[model samples]
Target: MTLRGERQADFAYQAVYRYMINLINEVSTDTRVKLPSLRQLSQRLNVSISTIQYAYSLLEKEGRVYSVAKSGYYAWPLSGSPSTLPSGDLLERLYVAARRPGMVVLSADEPALLASLDATLLRLERELVRQHPRHLQSWSQPCGVWELRAALAARYTSSPSRCWHADDVYIGADLRGVLDILIEVLGLRGSTVIVESPCDWLILRLLQDAGVRIIELPWAPDGRLDLPALEGTLIEETVQLVLLSSAVSLPSGVAMQPFERLEVARLLEQYGCWLLENDTYSELGFQPQQAALRDLVNPDRLVVFSCFEKILGPEAPYGYLLSRHMSGELQRQFLLRSFRLSSIRQRAIARLYHSGQIDQHLNTLRQLLREQAGEMSQRLDHHLGDQVTYRMPSGGATFWLGSVHAVDMRQVFQHLLARQVVVAPGELFSLGGLHSQHVRLSHTFHGQPNLEIALAALGEALRQAQLG
Candidate 1:
């Protein structure tokens, strides 16, 4: 073959090969991902048609990708996975993940921690110059920055006490980083992971993608996991880690009651199992009176993850994990995957958090959300008597919703989307049949124009979907 031909082939192969690796990481490994058509990809990437086809062929030969007759190339479902996924210092990954298309993220329960950053930007710049203008030039050292970690410890503000130290805190860039760290520290392979039924879609998708066997702990009204059902599932499933939401469970917005947490923590401690507390939405609370699972117990079995995305908005890039023991291996994995977030951002976050605007905005937002959420709740209540079920969280931004079984939420979703009304479908939360009759509503018609009008349109769609 000519050198030009070989070179073109190699470039195409490299491109397609890279795409496959990213596909596995970005999309789930347990599911099939439709690859773009050769012509489509070529047009988009400014590559030649033959190159795209040749690249796919090379990937197919190597078992990275496959093609079905009469169908397009698709990335093969992965197992355990290769080291092809990019490893960055964390900041780069954070920037990139934040920029992805359709990330219209309303899934994780991150609070808006960066409002402080906005409020403090001018002063923060001055402080940076005064304290350490060359901060960006410095490399992140052992145990992360002391001040940043200390700020994180202070930010958490646990009810009883801070169970962690400034040295104990390390900030990564969202749920993904926290998960990677926990997975590394915990040695999760071949281990059963427990998730609540109707949990965060991304969490479900991530664990599902990793080939993790999942046990759906029943999430009842009081944010209590159905004990009998969970015990039976645990015995039957050999659950290794129990992912609980102490402060703010995503999508559901239900915080585990203190008593329920005490019971669950005891059960988990007895089993010698681990609990991953996702308090990502903890900051959404405006009330001074709320409990955290981490606060109620001191068991070595729990690791809590909280992030800064929900209220402050997406790509704000900060997540922290407080564990009983952070192993060297775990730290290694975090440092290795650290490409997803930046120390610069973490540094700024430390400064902003210290400035205290996050607390102030959170208070304002909490009051606003409480009032708005109540309005929406009343609207939902008025519309559907038993046709819909929802959580009226004492605090936090999102809530769990269940609709009448007769309502095919998918159809309702499609109909509403056609009408430009966006709402999270219930199936995203459940393990199929059980949650098919629900939809979580996070946005309320608080300020924007025609709020009631849009909701009415969606309500009509719901009526049709249910009635039909």
Candidate 2:
């Protein structure tokens, strides 16, 4: 309402509004609709918050965008979608749904035994003190410390035909950090990227943020990759990249079989596309194998992303990107971005490997997880068997549950949260916004007794929702 300065700001806002309209028109699909954040757009367009606010307000009035309470704005309603919940709404809604204190979180993929981290943390502390002087002096190389890389290479080499070179490994701050770098380095924006339907929520978010043309291939009800559907998609279209959680499917906890992986590899080979194997849950599986689908194909055709954050906890933030032939490109990108890791973390992880403490930790974890999963599986089957359908994946931190009826899983999830429990709603995992009757529960968050209670509460919630 002011004079000349207001006029300038109004002009900027109008420009940004037009840019946003063009962006939404170009990127949004009939099923998957994505929109950029106010902060992102403001920065990109060199505009202020007031300008963005005005633009967003105009868009809202025009029905071009809709804002979630505390979350950002969305471009349009996804056609044939089960839920209109935007990714930005997920964290806030989950937080609000948690109505009581000391809530049981069955939605997170955390360690079942928090005490199991004691020894690892102690070892890390010792390593930090030992390397205090060195850590203070310098930053890590873009490719990371050689000691850690060698340790990881040796770990892979122990399994037959899975030997890796230190140079092929590039380390980053964490799982998200490494993935962000890979998406940019690989130039996946505007490329046709294939992912599983009901895939990892984080993966879906990342792909959507990167502006990739996403194609979701539905996984079979048995939790295996729908190979026929995948083959059809591969032959019918040109796919730039395929993201697979081969070791353990996040949220769903399904593990892709070796032969199933081989078939996927064949399709990629036939199509000449890159397969990024997400091995975040690699160390947590039952029958841990060294040979991956990457081993079956031209090493250049695959990239493996794994991190110690899941195993060693979030305090130890480090993950590796193993690209057989893209090391040079990754190195270039690393240098260009000046990405660096803490030398202390690299040393701590290396020390964990050399002292054989890593193996001990993993062995204990595997046995405990297997037992915990068994108990949780039995509890779910006994309590929710009649109301929901589910399968105990071979190895992973979570389980997938689908309702027997056509119910909105977000509502059921919110109901469970109100009852002091939280489970991941299925809508978050889909790019196409399908599968609203499913939910994910992570067994690792609580011990058997508490988990039993959570499962029982979930059953009651389902029943109440159905009746209501």
Candidate 3:
């Protein structure tokens, strides 16, 4: 039997709704049993609350469930034999498989230049000896080591807008910590912040856990900023800041157009909202660089942030925040929170930047990533054929793929995980419903041969899933 209002076409919300139906059938052995709350179900299923509500509405229309005004949905178990929900063990097993050491992991955020990291670290070691003993002994000033800041300043001065200065740079050992501090420093608590749906999952999770009031704007499938919607939202809500990834977005690797960035800045200025531009993957672009919002927007209204993890390695993860509107009190607050900085590490990074090695490394890294992305895309196309579709990432390490047919991504993720192949479920990237059949694959972790093997394995898994 088919579900009412169900269509055969692929859509994220429909997929989630169908899954909810199956879940009710699989569970609901007793009548009037309360279903999980929308928030609870959303978190458990990695879907959005709106998706759950839509599914519930459909179920209510079909008389499969009933809702209490202030309570929640409840299943109406029919007499005689009854069906039960799928075992919760499904997701448990999937996460466990993802953790296996030898799994064909495609969700890794590791750098593509894996082999060259050792060489870079060795160079850092060599450069570290040149720093004065006194500099190493004392605590780094809150603004960070002067040499590193100066190096960062030099790099930014090369851009179209030569506004960055040594004093404008602030270093943080942990990117997330720095961001949290920035949010507080900006006095944005209890204020509405706008973020893109399907943004960096880690960042999304961080914001959620921090209890920030967020308004997530759904990104169009084509990867452009929904400006009209954004402006509408700004008009309707009081937004303190807009967190944007202007270079390459996570999962999708889609870049914002140059004009779009400028327009977004203009809108933010008009609405009196600050723009925190995250350009972490900007250096990975394969073509000529596009203009950044930092160059287009008034410096007082825009603060740019990026980390070394993409260019350097995970072991050396430090980030720099550049802002022109920072006040003495704000700087002091930031410094007060971070009493000590890693002087040695800062000096090493400074050497890499000052000696031009950073640029040379980036030139090579970008080419390597481009080749890896190409290999992954070609392999998927050759093996999966029409079963899957994906766009070749222009920058960043991940490719967001959508299934060509109706398939439960959760089941597919499980099947692939059982075979020790790991991919990120699309639902994990958004706060609400998404293209549920979508999955994310990372190309930075493996070389061509291993990538080919993983793709072949994934193709087999897809075939199996389709058959079932």
TM-score of each: 0.71, 0.76, 0.74
Candidate 2 positional error at 30, Å: 39
- Model 2, span 1-468: residue lDDT tens: 122243343145556767778887887665445466766765666655444655665675455665554356766643523243334576545533332235676776665343255456656756676657652535437678888988887776534656688887888755655787899989999989888777776677777888989999877788788899888888888898888875667666677787898888888888898888877777788776545566676567778888876677654556688876766778887666544454555777788898898788888787777877787788887998898888776676677888996675666776776566778788878969776788878777444446677788888788767733
> What tens-digit string does per-residue lDDT give for candidate 3 at 308-383?
7777874355667887766585577666664344466677778888788888888888888888778767777797
**Lowest lDDT 10-residue stretch of candidate 2:** 1-10
Instruction: Name the lDDT of candidate 2.
Output: 0.70
Model 2: how far residue 442 lies from native, Å:
1.5
The candidates, ranked best first by TM-score, are 2, 3, 1
Candidate 1 wrong stretches, greater than 4 Å:
1-131, 142-144, 154-162, 221-223, 338-344, 382-387, 444-446
Which candidate should be chosen as best, given TM-score against the real structure?
Answer: 2
**Tens digits of per-residue lDDT for model 1, 189-265:** 66788887777766775676566777777577666668777677667667889887766565666666667777876
Query: Which pairs clash inside model 2?
Result: none
Q: What is the lDDT of candidate 3?
A: 0.69
Task: Superpose all Cα atoms of candidate 1 onto the true structure and report the RMSD in Å to 1 decimal.
Answer: 11.3
Candidate 2 stretches greater than 4 Å from native: 1-88, 95-101, 112-115, 158-162, 288-290, 336-340, 445-453
Ranking by lDDT: 2, 3, 1
Cα lDDT listed for each candidate: 0.59, 0.70, 0.69
